[model samples]
Target: MKKPQRSTAIFLLILSALLLVAMATFFYLKTQRQSAKTSPTKPALTVSTAALEQSLLPQRLSANGAIWPWQEAVIGSEAGGLRLTEVRVNVGDQVRKGQILATFAIESVQAEVAQAQASLAEAQANALDAAGNAEKARSLQRSGALSEQQINQFQTAEKTASARMLSARAMLEVQQVKLKQTRLLAPDDGVISARNATLGAVVGAGSELFRMIRGGRLEWRAEVTSSELSRIKTGMSVNLLAANGLPIKGKVRMIAPTVDPQTRLALVYVDLPLQAGAPNDPAAIRAGMFASGEFEMGKTMGLTAAQQSVLVRDGFSYVYTLGEDGHARQLKVQTGRRFGERIEIREGLAPGAVLVTSGAGFLNDGDLVRVVNPPMPPTASTAANPVPTKPQP
Candidate 1:
């Protein structure tokens, strides 16, 4: 009985030991599996990156404007209460300085001039008679044949006749001036932009007859914000887009001293060339035509990146900056003018920063990325098939 009991105890102990070994093996395998699942794997995305560099970029200011004449001449009538007899020039007619534009009725003015001439003739005859009488009176005064008062009266009569003759001559000169004014002449060489004078219409003095574009020159009036007005100066080159979609070159002529109260903008006057190149080629630009243009302020050193490196999201521009830990950090940036394939980085980016050039759109902030140097393509023979290895004996 004692031997059987001892064997039973030994078997129980051996079974307990085996159970402990099995439990330990199970827990070890479970821990190994949990650790394998928790460990992270490297990102699978391959991306290209570029280093930001400082480059000389052109600074430009853009604005919308209207084309206008450099100097608009308001041609009006100088003669009052005159009936227009002939309208020679109409709108769009090219005229020279002092060229006759219109004509007024000259019959009444010619009659007045004739009447003045007759009055002057009568006055001159009277003056001649007075001179002879005065000379006789002087001679009689010395001969004691005339009293002093009578001689004085003769001298006074001669003076009065001479004054009347002078007045009549002045009246004739006045009438001649009126006759010359019967024709309206262009003040300068220009193209007629507007005309209001009509045949048989009675026009008053200072009434507008025609509007001329002096020298046939046009200008671009650009409206710029108050902040940008200071950067513009005279002689700056501007590029204006014409209505015909052709680019017209212009130079800054003047800048308005005061800003418009309502729009809070200032006007920049740019002079357009009279002729683009040909004599017969009409000016491509016209007044009152809306234009869009840019002012080339100058060039400056700026940090720029390729257009692909930058991404726009959430109404803000962003770029993926390569991090030292093999990850991409999303950064916000302020952008400026764009030139060709590159964009100006105005703010939020530093020089010498590595930026992701490709696959930036698929990245998030602090996203792991695999940097890749693209491999060259294989040769045609290599791409066709692999060379079989020799069998070693």
Candidate 2:
């Protein structure tokens, strides 16, 4: 019985071994079938590329700034008295140089002028009479027909009358000039900025009445940081935007010699030209309207790319370049200055080299890419399939 049991155990062990082998074969076949069914299929990636070319770029710094008129002139009263009349020009109205803006009621001044004119006329007639009298007195004295004392008295009286006539004429001229000052005139061609005086209000001499921006052109006082200020110079190209969405082109007219101590900003004055083919009018731009500007310091010699074409991965910048064998070769790059839409490549790039302009982020090193509309097929080979390494026995 013990011998039969041992033989039975051995037979069972052999059957178990056969079953394990069959199970192993089934699993291996199943794995192979699944792998065949789900093999990775590579889809062709279409991309666009750009050729690198040497061009001018600018080193720019951005900062907040304000706008001011190119030629701001404060309108002030030159003569004291009451404001009697306001003219057609007010805030936002166009005015020409020497245009009457306002007037002060000077009834008293007018009366004084008339009085001085009358005094001048009377003095003129008296002076004529005095000349005749002096001539007659001198002739009488020469002929010995009148006493010397009498002739001398007549001569002194004539001289006194002539002096009075001259004084009266001087007074009349003074009154006329004063009367003209009562009418406020526009000092320059400009738009009225403010109207501080009203009819029936008294104003003192040198009092500020209205502010005007001289000339029809506008300007912007752009504030730039100390570092940025150094990069800019007079005559740099600039673009100006107004609060009302008006875009104007300009250039730097001047740069402040010293920066503001508190703000650490320097003022760059930009002169905005009138729109081409636009009619010139006095009411062009108002003073103190808010404006912003972009100044092109100049062309900076650096590699540049469109802002969308750059890629960032793992805290490093990268760009896809077409290698010699028609594949996307990823390269680490360093970038510098940025203009509106173009960025400068500071390092890791060469001029006149073609690179992937878009879709650089969706690529790996040595990726196989179909260049859409390329000039010619690249000479570089695509990446090869990675082989799996066998485990140690």
TM per candidate comes to 0.72, 0.73
Candidate 1 lDDT by residue in tens digits, 195-242: 988899999999998999899998889999999898998999998887
Candidate 2 colliding pairs: 52-352, 57-300, 303-345, 324-379, 324-380, 325-379, 325-380, 326-378, 326-380
Candidate 1 regions off by >4 Å? 1-49, 242-246, 261-263, 276-283, 320-331, 356-393
Q: Model 2, stretches more than 4 Å misplaced?
A: 1-63, 144-150, 227-230, 243-245, 274-286, 305-307, 312-332, 337-342, 348-393
lDDT values, one for every candidate: 0.89, 0.76
* Backbone Cα, N, C clashes tallied per candidate: 0, 9
Candidate 2 residue lDDT tens string, 259-317:
89998888888877744112344334444667776776556576788776788888988
